[model samples]
Target: MKTGVLLVNLGTPTAPTAKAVKSFLSQFLHDHRVVDVPRMLWCPLLHGVILPFRSPKVARLYQSVWWPEGSPLMVISRRQQAALSEALDRAGIRMPVALGMSYGEPSMATAWEELKAAGVGRVIILPLYPQYSVSTTASVFDSWARLMKKERLVPAFRFIHDYHDHSGYIQALADSVRAHWELHGRGELLLLSYHGIPQRYQDEGDPYGLQCHRTSELVAAQLGLERHQWRTTFQSRFGREPWLQPYTDGTMQALPGEGIKRLDVICPAFSADCLETLEEIAEQNRSLFLAAGGESYHYIAALNDSPGHIQLLMDLVCRELA
Candidate 1:
């Protein structure tokens, strides 16, 4: 049977402009999985207030991390696609790999078409999220289901859900931290920062937060970190609603006062260095900690297209294919 792979990530704007960001936000926020507010109230607020005001501000954040080629997320996803394809080929596995984004260009539909054209009869979908969350992984699955519903003949497919505690993934993450420490020296504290979800989500049995904590614990154990040397926190919280606590920004602000001046922060939730990791954690949080009396802050980059990351992806694919 001819097999193929579809790699998906959260989409990005075509450009770092207000108009582009608005368009992206319109689609992204409209997903019920993302914002559970009833449309009667949410629609007016989103269009009238949130999008109108947040777009310009978010556009600026995107601009800070935009690469000359394109948005950092899209750019890194492309590299990952190419790297995984190359790895598969090296293993003598002739699997066509296509890239997809949940909300924007080169979408799931486009990737499906590419796979169909390649004559794939079986496919594997691996969303770049290591941890499963309704907001992210389920959103990607919903997009795939919407596309498949319209198809006359759906192909055999497998979706890898929540590799958060995958041994290969944990090893790769630990390797990155070790490399960073070797180059810049170890910091006073290691902060494992993940994208935040609302507290209600956890109450609703969303295991995202738990998965994130497990991932951090595994990585920390591999690195032989003491309990006091590492911490897990959440970042990129939106709205005023309470989220998973020990908020990254607030923790960063307070860590310096507690004499944890030198810090190393990593976002295991992100597979690529996007606006969240690049601008929010690396730039914004770095400045916040520094201004709050932090002596030094190092933001460890994401796995991206690293050889180890590629191996991890390959291993995940192979396990399912087998």
Candidate 2:
């Protein structure tokens, strides 16, 4: 059977400019699943106030992590696509692999069209998020649904919602951590940090937080680390609302004072390093730790285009195809 694989990510700005950031934020924050406030109260607040005031600051954050190739998220995501395609070819799966960004360039519509043009009869969508959330996974599905509505012929479809508990995925994460420690030596403590969502989301039955903790525990167990040796935290909170805690920045800032001199941080929730992992965790949070009396701070890179990660992704795709 003819099959196509579509990989989607959260996306990044085309450029580190106010205009570009504004456009990116406009799409990102406007999603009802993201903001969750009633449109009557949220729409004006988003475009009128938040975009104007926050765009330039957010643009600066993007500038800090912007690479010669482009946003790290897009760059690594493209590399992942290439790696997965190569793996599939080696496995004798001749399928078209396309990358889509849920909120920016290489959009869902374009990816779907490419699959259609390639004469695919079945399409499998794999969002890069390891833990499922309505804001992330469901949003991807919503985009696909919209695209399918106008299609002359809708292909058979399947979605890989979350692979947090996948053995290959957990092994890939453990491998990355081990590789990092092998080169730099183990830190005084290892911090598993995932992106935070509003407490309201979890209260409303989001499984994201629970799955993140499960991934952390599984990875820690694989490393044979004690409970106190590693812990999980959340980051990237916005607004005055409560979010999943202990917050990553707060933990980093407090660790040094608590006599934890050296630390290693990893964001397993992200399949690829983006502005959140690069600028926020590696740069900003690193500085926060160092300035607050930390002797050494290391940021473990995300599993982006790594051999193990590619294999894990291929395993997930093949399982879905089978």
User: What clash count goes with each model?
Assistant: 0, 0
User: Cα miss at 85, model 1 (Å)?
Assistant: 0.2
Clashing pairs in 1: none
Question: Candidate 2 residues 24-138, lDDT tens each?
Answer: 9999998888888999999998889999999999999999889999989989999999999999999998999999989989898888878888998899999999999988999
**Count: clashes, candidate 1:** 0
How accurate locally is residue 125 in candidate 2, as Cα lDDT from 0 to 100? 94
lDDT of candidate 1 over 1-322, digit per residue (tens): 7999999999999999999999999999999999999999999999999999999999999988889999989989999999999999999999999999999898899999999999998999999999999999999999999998998989899999989999999999999999999999999999999999999999999999999999989999999999999999999999999999889999999998899999999999999999989999999999999999999899999999999999999999999987
lDDT of 1 at 304: 97
Worst 10 residues of 2 by lDDT: 108-117
Give residue 305's error in model 1 in angstroms. 0.3
Among these predicted structures, which one has the highest TM-score?
Answer: 1
**Each model's TM-score?**
0.99, 0.98
User: What pairs collide in candidate 2?
Assistant: none
Global local distance difference test of model 2: 0.93
lDDT of 1 at 260: 99
Query: What value does the lDDT take at residue 125 in candidate 1?
Result: 95
